[model samples]
Target chain A: MSIRDLARHLDISIGTVSRALNGKSDVNPETRERVLAAAKKLGYVPNQSGRSLRQGTTNTIGFMIESTIETADNGGSFFMPVFEGVQSVFRRHHLDLVALLCGTDEDPSAYLNRVVGRRFVDGLIISATTRNDPRITFLLDRKIPFVALGRSATGGAYPWIDLDFEGVAATAVTRLVNFGHNRIAIGVPASDINLGYVFQDGYKHALAANGIPFDPALVLPAHSNEEGGYQVASAMLAQKHMPTAVILVNENMAIGLYRRFYEAGIHPGRDIAVIGFRESTQSRFLSPTLTCFRISLRDLGIKLAEALLSTMPAFRNNYPQERVELIWPMELVPGESDVLKRTA
Target chain B: MSIRDLARHLDISIGTVSRALNGKSDVNPETRERVLAAAKKLGYVPNQSGRSLRQGTTNTIGFMIESTIETADNGGSFFMPVFEGVQSVFRRHHLDLVALLCGTDEDPSAYLNRVVGRRFVDGLIISATTRNDPRITFLLDRKIPFVALGRSATGGAYPWIDLDFEGVAATAVTRLVNFGHNRIAIGVPASDINLGYVFQDGYKHALAANGIPFDPALVLPAHSNEEGGYQVASAMLAQKHMPTAVILVNENMAIGLYRRFYEAGIHPGRDIAVIGFRESTQSRFLSPTLTCFRISLRDLGIKLAEALLSTMPAFRNNYPQERVELIWPMELVPGESDVLKRTA
Candidate 1:
């Protein structure tokens, strides 16, 4: 029902009816009550465009993610739990969470600009950060309240929560080294995503610490999915010397890696040791269970929400903090996939 | 920049500036061109709230999905491709697609009311429809343009595109019966989701066709995830007489079923035949590859977009149809999981 209709029914001015509906103090209590009663009885829903224009807030938060072939393969599994966690916190504050998916055809920066320009949300949580993400710079310049799910080298004092890819790689290398494996290979994303650089750097640093020279040939770059995992295994086989053990940055890749190895009669735990990035449903069900890192995705999401809220002026008091930069830690889950012992 | 700022800079009244910016016919052509150039140069992003309030359209579409624990287990993999397809179509019309996640704490009908009340989108695509959904009635009452990804028992002249769950059940049952298995079990969702009822109906009809009596004991209900699949296997082992063949309604359940069977020393392809509902990444890598149904999610998404657009007045001409009620088809991908033959 329109404001005019509500006003006509109440025998009052449309301004009075609108003021009463919006909880303005100018309207008398008895008249305000009558307007509200009639409006509720008549099922009047306030126009959000009108309300937002006046209040400058939509009571909504956006979580931006990319929709790509690689994302379609396994990104959903990674983000679903996080979305749930973010929503769980938002629900308490009567805020809604909407996911803004950046299509493959659109550049991430352009998508961010469109969304921000529209004032579609009060805050944002952007994931899959690149080495020098333009979206970060755009958001920073706009003074928009946002949190990055991963780190970027964009030179900003913005909050971000990144997974400890460096630590994961280093731990994997140390574990494999303790088993007396001299030749070790690592699988990382071929893209310019910031995590890949951190992961490879950790691998190189660990190699140096173990007194083993870094071999460029031992580093394999591909998409971070099952297909990429299969390609990594194929590339290893074609190499001049195959590594005794390998580390994968994505758990989904383990499926393809196993499939390729299975076809060649090279079982992961028996023929060659393997360490996967994170524990997942598929990883748990793999024949020789995948030895991977585990993290509470839901908790990570909760922290992400708090971090974002801490930056926004409206909710900053509730989540008071100096800064929210953090490297989320993961625990190692031992399994048969990395049980192979190598002779020195 | 605000309209006032633009007007001041251009030495024009706010009303003239607004008219020129909105391309109103009353504005002189020269003034309109001058305002447009200055607006562009000054990086003036037209306030969407103001624009939408005047136009009565948001140029946005909402895809409503649930964020339940069961959804977290596997829903992301199912929706990402569909989002891509829907965005692909929306991108052509310059319409933005945002995913509205209904949290577990709030009732879906209530959530829909708030979103619709806010006039958030021009159209909507709602998924995971339940039997006799209240959201359908609410939307119908509000005269909102929407399409359902799954069908509902809710009596309404609304468009929906649902999977052929009944056909999948019948096909699986027929194939298992042809393998000389008199007793067959089916795993279905324990919830009141419409698909569960449809799937069971197909199973019953198929049994009758084979001259077999309906056995309530053979139908097992659980969540449509890996944990549910494991429970189904556990329930089967506890039965007085285990069915020789079993069909699952979700491919994700295969992981749990396989794990359970492994612990119980009952091989799926050898000891008992199994037919999974849909083919997925997990299904492909399954030791004894899962015999499951396959459907192109991207195509399904494209159809869903077309169906929703057909119902919307602005885009109806482009996707003209009397109605969009359709049962999306699936093809069986033969695998070793259900290859067991029983000698009667």
Candidate 2:
């Protein structure tokens, strides 16, 4: 009937049963299993059998997402896995995760300020950070425990977890160069986000390391979605010295790139090699399959939550040593799209 | 500096400026453009320039999403457009929408009850309903204003705006039947959800109308995702009848279905006709394109919000004529994947 009933049936103390059910480390694994089996057998749902309002904490964190045209384009994906990762970490503490939408027309700082000012959440996790994000400073001014999913230029000691976009670009470029690709064109986001700059820096450094002159014209600034990828295709093809291989800054762009390649009667793996920045379901479904970088979004999300928890005093004991900055790495998942060997 | 300053500069009334900026219908089109241009020129951020805690309302709506393993494979995309739709209407009411995640292991009813008891949201819009969802009854008993994104057999009049699964199934079955296919397999969720039953009912009715008997073996129930779609492939091939066509219950599953078909050397539109349940960016990007149903998720979301507002005492006037039940329609979108005309 209740947790107490299950505890009595198991002949275990209520505290032990509660710890085991809540995934506390203090409980013995065997005891935890016994407690769980007893609870299941008794049909005891630990959560809401005359539950009281959670004490002190709201037990909720907010993840602010960008609401724009592109989000709807790819079936509104882009953030689901990362969300799952955050939730996994939060659920351990029974902290619920809620998504806050920032409309395309709204000012990010103002929108965020209202949410934080209301103290609707215990902490926050925000993504799509601008190169010089004011929201970071805004959060700090309010002394709100938070984590930015991407790095920001705001000068301060704050918790953050960002994908190693520089490393991804370097690895992608170096791999293509090793395949004898001399004229490698890259498509970066036209947005003034920090990730774009970091990604491009790695790309330029990789090119220079290989003794290849980085042409400004070779870098294409486009939207971060499929349409952005498609818009860059014609210009890429019409270049004076057409690129033999292309490195895309975002994986979602691969969808449009594939469409362009298909329409132009060009084979992705042969006519021109393509390497996407991220590996996504759509990229995996691409005809030639996309050679892209793989970052465990869920893992990144867990790290993000942990990073935020480290900042909060209430959760400091669980998180322990502070992790103020983290540059998460991504690995290569090779596919036919980037397997072209250039003879020239 | 502010909306008032912009209005003063434009020599327009403050009400006109506010209406124009918030996208209210009272403002003249040309005047709205002028107000916008002036606001941009003056660098005015209207919503939160000096906005404070909103009175009379928490000004937040919760959109509960199910966080499960199947969601990750599909990019967790099903609800985004709908979110956008909800936000579009909510923004008009100065209400913000937030996504509430229901953990894979957690009970939905418990989660909903916790959130409601905490008074965290003004209203709720919950999706992925089961046949006899206790959450609906729980919310109703609490006198909470909420909307179900899917239908349920809970034996009460509640504001629900669910997709017409029955119509979708019937239409898909009829189309496949007209393509000269007698043996058709259909995939539905293995979970005891309401849509599964409604969809199957339509499938059975469609078959019966065509004078074909329903075979239990022909009804393949699996997870509602890509992996599930992949799992269904081998079984589909193993069937003694070897269905000439198959209907998928979820669009997200189509991604895996395509991959399995490719690996098995069976072309989707050629070897065996395939019809997916929904049209999305992924479906559009499919090699042969996907023949499926189409509905404006944003519009559906708007309707959902309006329906909820109709039930709420505070927002009842905005949506006077209460709509207790709505079966939203999904029109067919013809694509190459289901164009195989049976010559036999």
Q: Tell me, by lDDT, which candidate is best.
A: 1
Docking class of 1: medium
Candidate 1 lDDT over A1-344, as tens digits, reads: 67887888889999988899879999899999998888778778887767888888898999999998767878888998899899888877878999999998789988887887678699999999999998988888878899999998889799999999989998999999998888999999988889999999999999999999999999999888877888899988888878989999999888788878888778888889999998886667666789999999999999999999888888888886878999999999998898874343
Give the runs in model 2 whose Cα sits over 4 Å from its true position.
A1-57, A73-76, A282-285, A341-344, B1-56, B341-344
- Stretches of candidate 1 off by over 4 Å are A5-13, A24-43, A341-344, B1-17, B24-43, B341-344
* Candidate with the greatest DockQ versus the true structure: 1
Q: Candidate 2: global Cα-lDDT?
A: 0.79
* Candidate 1 lDDT by residue in tens digits, B39-149: 888767777777788888888899999888667778888999999999888887888999998987779888887887777688899988998898898888878899999
Q: Candidate 2's error at B180, in angstroms? A: 1.1
lDDT of each: 0.88, 0.79
- Residue A323 of model 1, lDDT score: 83
